[model samples]
Target: MQAAISFAISLVAMSFGIAKLPLGPWERGFLALGLIFVVTSSFTLAKCVRDRQEVTEVSSRVDKARLDKLLAEHDPFETKNL
Candidate 1:
């Protein structure tokens, strides 16, 4: 998809930029490490958000089903036996 393509392009561009930097190899290695950490953290955050949303949706569905079942069993005009 477009998002995948964009991500790839950006990663390549960043790598090239880092390679072209005048800094020492150690600095570049540090920057690459930071970039990797950021990317991994971003993925983790996105997965966590998705999982939470899915849980919320499932909880809502269960609540709605319970309400529907209660309503189905309810009878407004039924008189209770003494």
Candidate 2:
């Protein structure tokens, strides 16, 4: 919800600022398109980074759990440490 509101406000501000610029229709359109591309790419990059980190964390957790399970099942007295 907060993000939605912030996005709305920023969009409105950008529109107003762009309207004030003394640019032709093509130029304005290009500017808007560039802004959209930048914003979307930024979001995509951030999400990709976050997803990678999450995958790494999940992988590490799975590995840790597996190791813990193996340790729990092993009998220290009768087992050869390998």
| CA lDDT of each prediction against the hidden true structure | 0.93, 0.89
Q: Which parts of model 1 are misplaced by more than 4 Å?
A: none
Q: Choose the strongest candidate by TM-score.
A: 1
How does each model score on TM-score?
0.88, 0.76
- Find the 10 residues in a row with the least total lDDT in model 1: 34-43
lDDT of 1 by residue, 27-76 (tens): 99998998888888988999999999999999999999999999999999
Candidate 2 residue lDDT tens string, 28-71:
98889987897799789989999999999999999999999999
Report the lDDT of model 1 for residue 48.
100
For model 2, the stretches where C-alpha displacement exceeds 4 angstroms are: 1-3, 79-82
For residue 8, give model 1's deviation from the true position in Å. Answer: 2.0
Query: Candidate 2 overall Cα lDDT vs. reference?
Result: 0.89
Model 1, TM vs. native: 0.88
